[model samples]
Target: MKPLVILLAAAAAFGADPPAREKLPTSRADLENGEKLYQANCGLCHGTKGDGGRGAVLAGRKLSRAADDAALVKVIEEGVRGTEMPGAWQLSARESRQVAAFVRSLSRVSSKPVPGDPSRGAELYARNHCSACHTIRGLGGSAGPDLSDTGLRRNPAFLRTSLTDPEAELPRSYQLVSIRSNSGSTITGARLSEDSFSIQVGDSSGKVHSFWKHEISELKKERGKSAMPSYKQLSSADLDDLVAYLSSLKEAS
Candidate 1:
Protein backbone atom coordinates (compact mmCIF):
# COMPACT_ATOMS: atom_id res chain seq x y z
CA MET A 1 0.00 0.00 0.00
CA LYS A 2 1.10 3.61 -0.58
CA PRO A 3 2.38 5.70 2.36
CA LEU A 4 -0.38 8.28 1.96
CA VAL A 5 -2.99 5.53 1.94
CA ILE A 6 -1.45 4.08 5.11
CA LEU A 7 -1.54 7.53 6.68
CA LEU A 8 -5.18 8.12 5.80
CA ALA A 9 -6.19 4.66 6.97
CA ALA A 10 -4.52 5.21 10.35
CA ALA A 11 -6.21 8.58 10.74
CA ALA A 12 -9.59 7.03 9.98
CA ALA A 13 -8.96 4.40 12.63
CA PHE A 14 -8.58 7.00 15.36
CA GLY A 15 -11.21 9.50 14.16
CA ALA A 16 -11.35 12.74 16.16
CA ASP A 17 -9.48 11.56 19.26
CA PRO A 18 -6.29 9.57 19.57
CA PRO A 19 -6.37 5.89 20.38
CA ALA A 20 -5.71 4.75 23.94
CA ARG A 21 -2.29 3.30 23.16
CA GLU A 22 0.13 4.59 20.52
CA LYS A 23 1.51 1.86 18.32
CA LEU A 24 5.23 2.59 17.92
CA PRO A 25 7.57 1.14 15.35
CA THR A 26 9.12 -1.85 17.12
CA SER A 27 11.55 -3.44 14.70
CA ARG A 28 15.13 -2.13 14.37
CA ALA A 29 14.49 -1.18 10.76
CA ASP A 30 11.36 0.68 11.72
CA LEU A 31 13.13 2.54 14.52
CA GLU A 32 15.96 3.49 12.21
CA ASN A 33 13.49 4.73 9.66
CA GLY A 34 11.85 6.92 12.32
CA GLU A 35 15.20 8.33 13.38
CA LYS A 36 16.03 9.27 9.82
CA LEU A 37 12.68 11.00 9.46
CA TYR A 38 13.21 12.80 12.76
CA GLN A 39 16.66 14.03 11.75
CA ALA A 40 15.40 15.31 8.43
CA ASN A 41 12.27 16.94 9.81
CA CYS A 42 12.74 17.82 13.51
CA GLY A 43 16.47 18.08 14.14
CA LEU A 44 16.81 21.68 12.98
CA CYS A 45 14.57 22.95 15.76
CA HIS A 46 14.25 20.20 18.38
CA GLY A 47 17.89 19.07 18.09
CA THR A 48 19.06 15.58 17.27
CA LYS A 49 18.74 14.47 20.89
CA GLY A 50 15.85 16.88 21.54
CA ASP A 51 17.98 18.79 24.07
CA GLY A 52 16.43 21.93 22.58
CA GLY A 53 17.93 25.08 21.12
CA ARG A 54 15.37 27.09 19.22
CA GLY A 55 12.66 24.75 20.47
CA ALA A 56 11.69 23.54 23.92
CA VAL A 57 13.85 20.76 25.33
CA LEU A 58 12.45 17.27 24.92
CA ALA A 59 15.28 15.08 26.24
CA GLY A 60 14.74 13.74 29.75
CA ARG A 61 11.80 16.07 30.18
CA LYS A 62 8.03 15.93 30.08
CA LEU A 63 6.36 17.49 27.07
CA SER A 64 3.54 19.95 27.57
CA ARG A 65 1.67 18.76 24.49
CA ALA A 66 -0.09 15.45 24.84
CA ALA A 67 2.67 13.32 26.37
CA ASP A 68 1.11 9.91 25.72
CA ASP A 69 1.84 8.01 22.57
CA ALA A 70 -1.53 8.66 20.97
CA ALA A 71 -1.71 12.26 22.09
CA LEU A 72 1.82 12.88 20.89
CA VAL A 73 0.81 11.49 17.53
CA LYS A 74 -2.16 13.83 17.40
CA VAL A 75 -0.05 16.84 18.36
CA ILE A 76 2.45 15.99 15.66
CA GLU A 77 -0.28 15.58 13.08
CA GLU A 78 -2.45 18.57 14.00
CA GLY A 79 0.01 20.94 15.75
CA VAL A 80 -0.64 23.63 18.36
CA ARG A 81 -2.23 26.89 17.30
CA GLY A 82 -0.76 30.35 17.98
CA THR A 83 2.65 28.88 18.57
CA GLU A 84 5.85 28.27 16.61
CA MET A 85 4.91 24.58 16.27
CA PRO A 86 3.40 23.71 12.93
CA GLY A 87 1.54 20.64 11.75
CA ALA A 88 3.66 18.15 9.84
CA TRP A 89 0.98 17.51 7.26
CA GLN A 90 3.69 16.75 4.73
CA LEU A 91 4.47 13.53 6.56
CA SER A 92 2.20 10.51 6.32
CA ALA A 93 0.15 9.61 9.39
CA ARG A 94 2.24 6.48 9.92
CA GLU A 95 5.36 8.65 9.78
CA SER A 96 3.79 11.01 12.26
CA ARG A 97 3.17 8.12 14.64
CA GLN A 98 6.68 6.86 14.09
CA VAL A 99 8.20 10.25 14.87
CA ALA A 100 5.97 10.61 17.92
CA ALA A 101 7.17 7.26 19.23
CA PHE A 102 10.79 8.22 18.59
CA VAL A 103 10.23 11.52 20.40
CA ARG A 104 8.60 9.67 23.30
CA SER A 105 11.56 7.34 23.56
CA LEU A 106 13.76 10.41 24.11
CA SER A 107 12.43 11.31 27.57
CA ARG A 108 10.09 10.40 30.42
CA VAL A 109 9.03 12.51 33.36
CA SER A 110 8.18 11.19 36.81
CA SER A 111 4.55 10.12 37.18
CA LYS A 112 4.43 10.63 40.93
CA PRO A 113 1.28 12.49 41.91
CA VAL A 114 1.75 15.78 43.69
CA PRO A 115 0.97 15.77 47.42
CA GLY A 116 -1.00 18.28 49.56
CA ASP A 117 -4.18 20.22 48.95
CA PRO A 118 -4.17 22.20 45.71
CA SER A 119 -6.64 24.74 47.09
CA ARG A 120 -4.43 25.40 50.10
CA GLY A 121 -1.46 25.52 47.75
CA ALA A 122 -3.28 28.12 45.69
CA GLU A 123 -3.58 30.31 48.74
CA LEU A 124 0.08 29.85 49.54
CA TYR A 125 1.03 30.68 45.96
CA ALA A 126 -0.69 34.03 46.21
CA ARG A 127 0.49 34.69 49.76
CA ASN A 128 4.10 34.15 48.74
CA HIS A 129 3.72 36.52 45.76
CA CYS A 130 4.49 33.83 43.20
CA SER A 131 2.40 35.75 40.70
CA ALA A 132 4.64 38.76 41.11
CA CYS A 133 6.98 37.03 38.70
CA HIS A 134 5.17 34.09 37.17
CA THR A 135 1.93 34.07 35.19
CA ILE A 136 -0.86 31.50 35.42
CA ARG A 137 -3.57 31.48 32.78
CA GLY A 138 -2.42 35.01 31.82
CA LEU A 139 -3.29 36.48 35.21
CA GLY A 140 0.15 37.42 36.54
CA GLY A 141 3.47 39.03 35.71
CA SER A 142 5.77 37.74 32.96
CA ALA A 143 9.15 37.96 34.69
CA GLY A 144 9.10 34.19 35.11
CA PRO A 145 7.78 31.36 33.03
CA ASP A 146 4.02 31.05 32.72
CA LEU A 147 2.87 28.48 35.27
CA SER A 148 -0.10 27.62 33.09
CA ASP A 149 1.70 24.48 31.91
CA THR A 150 4.56 23.89 34.34
CA GLY A 151 3.08 20.63 35.52
CA LEU A 152 3.11 19.15 32.05
CA ARG A 153 6.57 20.54 31.27
CA ARG A 154 8.33 19.67 34.50
CA ASN A 155 8.23 16.66 36.83
CA PRO A 156 7.36 16.72 40.54
CA ALA A 157 10.95 16.24 41.70
CA PHE A 158 12.12 19.10 39.49
CA LEU A 159 9.42 21.39 40.87
CA ARG A 160 10.38 20.59 44.46
CA THR A 161 14.03 21.21 43.76
CA SER A 162 13.25 24.48 41.98
CA LEU A 163 11.64 25.88 45.14
CA THR A 164 14.39 24.61 47.42
CA ASP A 165 17.33 25.56 45.19
CA PRO A 166 16.43 27.73 42.24
CA GLU A 167 19.89 27.65 40.73
CA ALA A 168 20.01 23.91 40.19
CA GLU A 169 18.86 23.92 36.58
CA LEU A 170 18.19 27.56 35.86
CA PRO A 171 18.08 28.23 32.15
CA ARG A 172 20.30 30.95 30.73
CA SER A 173 17.19 32.59 29.33
CA TYR A 174 15.96 33.38 32.88
CA GLN A 175 19.20 34.93 34.13
CA LEU A 176 18.97 38.27 35.96
CA VAL A 177 20.59 41.43 34.66
CA SER A 178 21.50 44.85 36.06
CA ILE A 179 22.26 47.84 33.90
CA ARG A 180 23.45 51.21 35.14
CA SER A 181 22.76 54.16 32.87
CA ASN A 182 25.16 57.09 32.56
CA SER A 183 22.66 59.28 34.39
CA GLY A 184 23.01 57.22 37.62
CA SER A 185 19.79 55.27 37.10
CA THR A 186 19.84 51.49 37.51
CA ILE A 187 17.51 48.92 35.96
CA THR A 188 17.47 45.39 37.31
CA GLY A 189 15.38 42.94 35.41
CA ALA A 190 15.23 39.61 33.60
CA ARG A 191 16.83 39.61 30.19
CA LEU A 192 14.28 39.39 27.39
CA SER A 193 16.76 39.59 24.54
CA GLU A 194 20.27 40.81 24.00
CA ASP A 195 22.64 41.67 21.22
CA SER A 196 25.99 43.41 20.95
CA PHE A 197 24.32 46.81 20.55
CA SER A 198 21.15 46.64 22.64
CA ILE A 199 19.36 44.65 25.36
CA GLN A 200 15.74 44.22 26.42
CA VAL A 201 14.63 43.43 29.95
CA GLY A 202 11.44 42.78 31.85
CA ASP A 203 11.65 44.27 35.32
CA SER A 204 10.03 42.93 38.50
CA SER A 205 7.23 45.44 38.15
CA GLY A 206 6.39 43.85 34.76
CA LYS A 207 7.80 46.84 32.96
CA VAL A 208 10.09 46.38 29.99
CA HIS A 209 13.30 48.38 29.60
CA SER A 210 15.35 48.53 26.44
CA PHE A 211 18.78 50.13 26.41
CA TRP A 212 21.59 50.58 23.93
CA LYS A 213 24.97 49.37 25.12
CA HIS A 214 26.61 52.75 24.59
CA GLU A 215 24.07 54.51 26.86
CA ILE A 216 24.72 52.19 29.81
CA SER A 217 27.69 52.81 32.09
CA GLU A 218 27.51 49.34 33.56
CA LEU A 219 25.83 46.10 32.56
CA LYS A 220 25.99 43.01 34.66
CA LYS A 221 24.72 39.60 33.63
CA GLU A 222 24.25 37.49 36.74
CA ARG A 223 24.82 33.96 35.57
CA GLY A 224 23.63 30.86 37.41
CA LYS A 225 21.05 32.92 39.29
CA SER A 226 17.34 33.66 39.24
CA ALA A 227 15.25 36.58 40.42
CA MET A 228 13.05 34.05 42.22
CA PRO A 229 14.09 33.50 45.81
CA SER A 230 14.47 30.09 47.37
CA TYR A 231 11.55 28.80 49.43
CA LYS A 232 13.65 26.99 52.01
CA GLN A 233 12.56 29.54 54.59
CA LEU A 234 8.95 28.47 54.29
CA SER A 235 7.59 26.06 56.87
CA SER A 236 7.59 22.41 55.78
CA ALA A 237 3.84 22.31 55.24
CA ASP A 238 3.79 25.57 53.40
CA LEU A 239 6.66 24.43 51.20
CA ASP A 240 4.89 21.23 50.28
CA ASP A 241 1.72 23.17 49.57
CA LEU A 242 3.54 25.55 47.27
CA VAL A 243 5.19 22.71 45.36
CA ALA A 244 1.90 20.87 45.20
CA TYR A 245 0.22 23.95 43.80
CA LEU A 246 2.87 24.62 41.21
CA SER A 247 3.02 20.99 40.16
CA SER A 248 -0.75 20.87 39.69
CA LEU A 249 -0.75 23.56 37.02
CA LYS A 250 -1.31 21.76 33.73
CA GLU A 251 -2.55 23.63 30.69
CA ALA A 252 -6.11 22.70 29.84
CA SER A 253 -6.25 20.61 26.68
Candidate 2:
Protein backbone atom coordinates (compact mmCIF):
# COMPACT_ATOMS: atom_id res chain seq x y z
CA MET A 1 0.00 0.00 0.00
CA LYS A 2 1.08 3.61 -0.57
CA PRO A 3 2.57 5.42 2.49
CA LEU A 4 -0.33 7.92 2.54
CA VAL A 5 -2.81 5.03 2.50
CA ILE A 6 -0.96 3.37 5.35
CA LEU A 7 -1.04 6.61 7.36
CA LEU A 8 -4.77 6.95 6.79
CA ALA A 9 -5.34 3.34 7.87
CA ALA A 10 -3.33 3.87 11.04
CA ALA A 11 -5.22 7.08 11.86
CA ALA A 12 -8.56 5.35 11.35
CA ALA A 13 -7.51 2.42 13.53
CA PHE A 14 -6.61 4.80 16.38
CA GLY A 15 -8.55 8.02 16.02
CA ALA A 16 -8.73 11.02 13.68
CA ASP A 17 -5.85 13.46 13.85
CA PRO A 18 -6.73 16.41 16.03
CA PRO A 19 -9.73 14.50 17.33
CA ALA A 20 -12.90 16.34 18.33
CA ARG A 21 -12.17 15.96 22.02
CA GLU A 22 -9.09 15.64 24.25
CA LYS A 23 -8.92 14.42 27.81
CA LEU A 24 -9.07 17.34 30.25
CA PRO A 25 -5.46 18.35 30.98
CA THR A 26 -5.06 18.71 34.74
CA SER A 27 -1.31 18.78 35.21
CA ARG A 28 0.45 21.92 36.45
CA ALA A 29 2.52 22.28 33.27
CA ASP A 30 -0.52 21.71 31.07
CA LEU A 31 -2.58 24.29 32.96
CA GLU A 32 0.28 26.79 32.80
CA ASN A 33 0.55 26.35 29.08
CA GLY A 34 -3.21 26.60 28.82
CA GLU A 35 -3.19 29.88 30.73
CA LYS A 36 -0.61 31.29 28.34
CA LEU A 37 -2.63 30.13 25.36
CA TYR A 38 -5.83 31.58 26.76
CA GLN A 39 -4.16 34.90 27.55
CA ALA A 40 -2.80 35.20 24.04
CA ASN A 41 -5.91 34.21 22.10
CA CYS A 42 -8.87 34.82 24.39
CA GLY A 43 -7.82 37.48 26.87
CA LEU A 44 -8.50 40.40 24.53
CA CYS A 45 -12.22 39.62 24.50
CA HIS A 46 -12.84 37.35 27.49
CA GLY A 47 -10.59 39.59 29.61
CA THR A 48 -7.14 38.91 30.96
CA LYS A 49 -8.68 37.17 33.95
CA GLY A 50 -11.80 35.98 32.11
CA ASP A 51 -13.84 38.80 33.64
CA GLY A 52 -15.40 39.33 30.19
CA GLY A 53 -15.50 42.25 27.80
CA ARG A 54 -16.42 41.88 24.15
CA GLY A 55 -16.94 38.16 24.79
CA ALA A 56 -18.92 36.44 27.52
CA VAL A 57 -17.44 36.12 31.00
CA LEU A 58 -15.65 32.87 31.74
CA ALA A 59 -15.27 33.06 35.48
CA GLY A 60 -17.51 32.39 38.48
CA ARG A 61 -20.71 31.73 36.48
CA LYS A 62 -21.83 28.86 34.29
CA LEU A 63 -21.08 29.02 30.59
CA SER A 64 -24.38 28.42 28.83
CA ARG A 65 -23.22 27.66 25.30
CA ALA A 66 -20.02 25.82 26.25
CA ALA A 67 -21.65 23.94 29.11
CA ASP A 68 -19.10 21.18 29.68
CA ASP A 69 -15.43 20.44 29.02
CA ALA A 70 -16.12 18.55 25.83
CA ALA A 71 -18.55 21.17 24.66
CA LEU A 72 -16.00 23.85 25.45
CA VAL A 73 -13.41 22.05 23.37
CA LYS A 74 -15.86 21.88 20.47
CA VAL A 75 -16.65 25.57 20.78
CA ILE A 76 -12.95 26.42 20.79
CA GLU A 77 -12.16 24.23 17.82
CA GLU A 78 -15.29 24.75 15.68
CA GLY A 79 -16.72 27.97 17.08
CA VAL A 80 -20.34 28.83 17.80
CA ARG A 81 -22.20 28.69 14.49
CA GLY A 82 -23.95 32.10 14.39
CA THR A 83 -22.39 34.24 17.08
CA GLU A 84 -19.32 36.48 17.12
CA MET A 85 -17.09 33.72 18.52
CA PRO A 86 -14.94 32.25 15.80
CA GLY A 87 -13.23 28.86 16.03
CA ALA A 88 -9.69 28.48 17.28
CA TRP A 89 -8.68 26.60 14.19
CA GLN A 90 -5.04 27.16 15.08
CA LEU A 91 -5.06 25.02 18.22
CA SER A 92 -4.42 21.30 18.02
CA ALA A 93 -6.73 18.88 19.80
CA ARG A 94 -4.42 18.57 22.80
CA GLU A 95 -4.06 22.33 23.09
CA SER A 96 -7.80 22.84 22.78
CA ARG A 97 -8.40 20.44 25.65
CA GLN A 98 -5.86 22.24 27.76
CA VAL A 99 -7.59 25.54 27.06
CA ALA A 100 -10.91 23.97 27.98
CA ALA A 101 -9.51 22.76 31.29
CA PHE A 102 -8.17 26.22 32.05
CA VAL A 103 -11.53 27.75 31.24
CA ARG A 104 -13.26 25.29 33.57
CA SER A 105 -10.82 26.18 36.33
CA LEU A 106 -11.61 29.90 35.95
CA SER A 107 -15.05 29.35 37.47
CA ARG A 108 -13.41 28.56 40.78
CA VAL A 109 -11.49 31.83 40.96
CA SER A 110 -13.10 34.03 43.57
CA SER A 111 -14.83 37.05 42.05
CA LYS A 112 -14.73 40.36 43.80
CA PRO A 113 -17.86 41.03 45.82
CA VAL A 114 -20.52 43.12 44.12
CA PRO A 115 -20.96 46.23 46.20
CA GLY A 116 -24.44 47.79 46.58
CA ASP A 117 -27.93 46.57 47.37
CA PRO A 118 -29.58 44.13 44.96
CA SER A 119 -33.07 45.12 46.15
CA ARG A 120 -32.46 48.78 45.41
CA GLY A 121 -31.05 47.88 42.02
CA ALA A 122 -34.15 45.84 41.24
CA GLU A 123 -36.29 48.90 41.98
CA LEU A 124 -34.06 50.99 39.77
CA TYR A 125 -34.43 48.49 36.95
CA ALA A 126 -38.23 48.70 37.08
CA ARG A 127 -38.22 52.48 37.51
CA ASN A 128 -36.11 52.80 34.40
CA HIS A 129 -38.37 50.43 32.48
CA CYS A 130 -35.44 48.17 31.69
CA SER A 131 -37.75 45.22 31.05
CA ALA A 132 -39.22 47.00 28.03
CA CYS A 133 -36.14 45.88 26.11
CA HIS A 134 -34.25 43.34 28.30
CA THR A 135 -35.49 40.14 29.90
CA ILE A 136 -34.95 38.54 33.29
CA ARG A 137 -35.87 35.02 34.31
CA GLY A 138 -38.79 34.26 31.93
CA LEU A 139 -40.28 37.74 31.63
CA GLY A 140 -39.58 40.87 29.52
CA GLY A 141 -38.91 41.73 25.89
CA SER A 142 -37.02 39.75 23.30
CA ALA A 143 -35.76 42.81 21.45
CA GLY A 144 -32.55 42.79 23.53
CA PRO A 145 -30.26 39.97 24.55
CA ASP A 146 -31.62 37.73 27.29
CA LEU A 147 -30.40 38.71 30.76
CA SER A 148 -31.50 35.53 32.48
CA ASP A 149 -27.84 34.66 32.93
CA THR A 150 -26.14 38.00 32.44
CA GLY A 151 -24.85 37.75 35.96
CA LEU A 152 -23.16 34.51 35.06
CA ARG A 153 -22.18 35.47 31.55
CA ARG A 154 -20.89 38.88 32.56
CA ASN A 155 -19.13 40.32 35.57
CA PRO A 156 -20.27 43.43 37.46
CA ALA A 157 -17.70 45.58 35.64
CA PHE A 158 -18.98 44.45 32.27
CA LEU A 159 -22.55 45.07 33.33
CA ARG A 160 -21.58 48.59 34.41
CA THR A 161 -19.91 49.31 31.08
CA SER A 162 -22.93 47.95 29.25
CA LEU A 163 -25.17 50.29 31.21
CA THR A 164 -22.95 53.33 30.75
CA ASP A 165 -21.74 52.81 27.20
CA PRO A 166 -23.99 50.40 25.42
CA GLU A 167 -22.55 51.32 22.03
CA ALA A 168 -19.05 50.26 23.06
CA GLU A 169 -19.80 46.58 22.56
CA LEU A 170 -23.12 46.59 20.75
CA PRO A 171 -23.97 42.95 20.08
CA ARG A 172 -24.06 42.48 16.34
CA SER A 173 -27.20 40.37 16.62
CA TYR A 174 -29.22 43.13 18.32
CA GLN A 175 -28.01 46.15 16.39
CA LEU A 176 -30.78 48.45 15.17
CA VAL A 177 -31.43 48.01 11.48
CA SER A 178 -33.47 50.02 9.01
CA ILE A 179 -35.28 48.65 6.00
CA ARG A 180 -37.05 50.59 3.28
CA SER A 181 -39.30 48.93 0.75
CA ASN A 182 -39.74 49.95 -2.88
CA SER A 183 -43.23 51.09 -1.86
CA GLY A 184 -41.69 54.16 -0.13
CA SER A 185 -42.33 52.74 3.36
CA THR A 186 -39.57 52.57 5.94
CA ILE A 187 -39.32 50.35 9.01
CA THR A 188 -36.63 50.84 11.61
CA GLY A 189 -36.39 48.17 14.23
CA ALA A 190 -34.33 45.30 15.68
CA ARG A 191 -33.14 42.99 12.96
CA LEU A 192 -34.70 39.61 13.67
CA SER A 193 -32.73 37.67 11.09
CA GLU A 194 -31.05 38.03 7.72
CA ASP A 195 -30.35 35.62 4.92
CA SER A 196 -29.36 35.55 1.30
CA PHE A 197 -32.85 36.42 0.08
CA SER A 198 -35.07 37.60 2.95
CA ILE A 199 -34.72 39.81 6.04
CA GLN A 200 -36.85 40.04 9.16
CA VAL A 201 -37.24 43.01 11.48
CA GLY A 202 -39.20 43.54 14.66
CA ASP A 203 -40.57 46.98 15.43
CA SER A 204 -40.78 48.45 18.92
CA SER A 205 -44.42 47.40 19.06
CA GLY A 206 -43.32 43.76 18.63
CA LYS A 207 -44.55 43.68 15.04
CA VAL A 208 -42.42 41.62 12.69
CA HIS A 209 -41.79 42.88 9.16
CA SER A 210 -40.44 40.62 6.47
CA PHE A 211 -39.21 41.59 3.03
CA TRP A 212 -37.39 40.04 0.12
CA LYS A 213 -34.10 41.48 -1.09
CA HIS A 214 -35.70 42.51 -4.35
CA GLU A 215 -38.45 44.38 -2.48
CA ILE A 216 -35.98 46.26 -0.32
CA SER A 217 -34.95 49.53 -1.90
CA GLU A 218 -32.71 50.40 1.02
CA LEU A 219 -31.40 48.30 3.90
CA LYS A 220 -28.91 49.69 6.34
CA LYS A 221 -27.43 48.18 9.47
CA GLU A 222 -26.43 50.79 12.03
CA ARG A 223 -23.11 49.40 13.24
CA GLY A 224 -21.51 50.48 16.54
CA LYS A 225 -24.94 51.61 17.68
CA SER A 226 -27.53 50.42 20.15
CA ALA A 227 -31.25 51.18 20.47
CA MET A 228 -30.86 51.11 24.24
CA PRO A 229 -29.92 54.48 25.62
CA SER A 230 -27.03 54.95 28.04
CA TYR A 231 -27.69 54.93 31.76
CA LYS A 232 -24.61 57.03 32.55
CA GLN A 233 -26.91 59.61 34.05
CA LEU A 234 -27.56 57.36 36.99
CA SER A 235 -26.00 58.46 40.24
CA SER A 236 -22.92 56.63 41.50
CA ALA A 237 -24.92 54.85 44.17
CA ASP A 238 -27.60 53.96 41.68
CA LEU A 239 -25.06 52.62 39.26
CA ASP A 240 -23.48 50.48 41.93
CA ASP A 241 -26.83 49.13 43.02
CA LEU A 242 -27.88 48.45 39.45
CA VAL A 243 -24.66 46.61 38.76
CA ALA A 244 -25.29 44.55 41.85
CA TYR A 245 -28.80 43.73 40.67
CA LEU A 246 -27.68 42.72 37.17
CA SER A 247 -24.78 40.69 38.55
CA SER A 248 -27.24 38.79 40.72
CA LEU A 249 -29.03 37.22 37.73
CA LYS A 250 -27.47 33.73 37.45
CA GLU A 251 -30.46 31.67 36.33
CA ALA A 252 -30.12 30.51 32.72
CA SER A 253 -32.78 27.81 32.65
Give me the candidate number with maximum TM-score.
2
Badly placed stretches (over 4 Å) of model 2 are 1-23, 61-72, 181-185, 204-207, 211-216
lDDT string, candidate 1, 133-226, tens digits? 8889989887777778776555555677788888877756777999999999999888978899999888887777899999999999898778
**TM-score, model 2 to reference:** 0.78
User: What digit string (tens of lDDT, one per residue) describes model 2 on residues 1-253?
Assistant: 6999999899897875665544698999999999999999988889888887767788876778876677888898998777678899999888888888899899788667889999999999999988876778878876677888788667777789899988877677877988889999999888878899999887765566789999999999887777777999999999999999998887865
Give per-model TM-scores: 0.62, 0.78
Q: Give the root-mean-square deviation of each candidate in angstroms.
A: 8.7, 4.5
Off by over 4 Å in 1: 1-23, 27-110
Residue 167 displacement in candidate 1 (angstroms) = 0.9
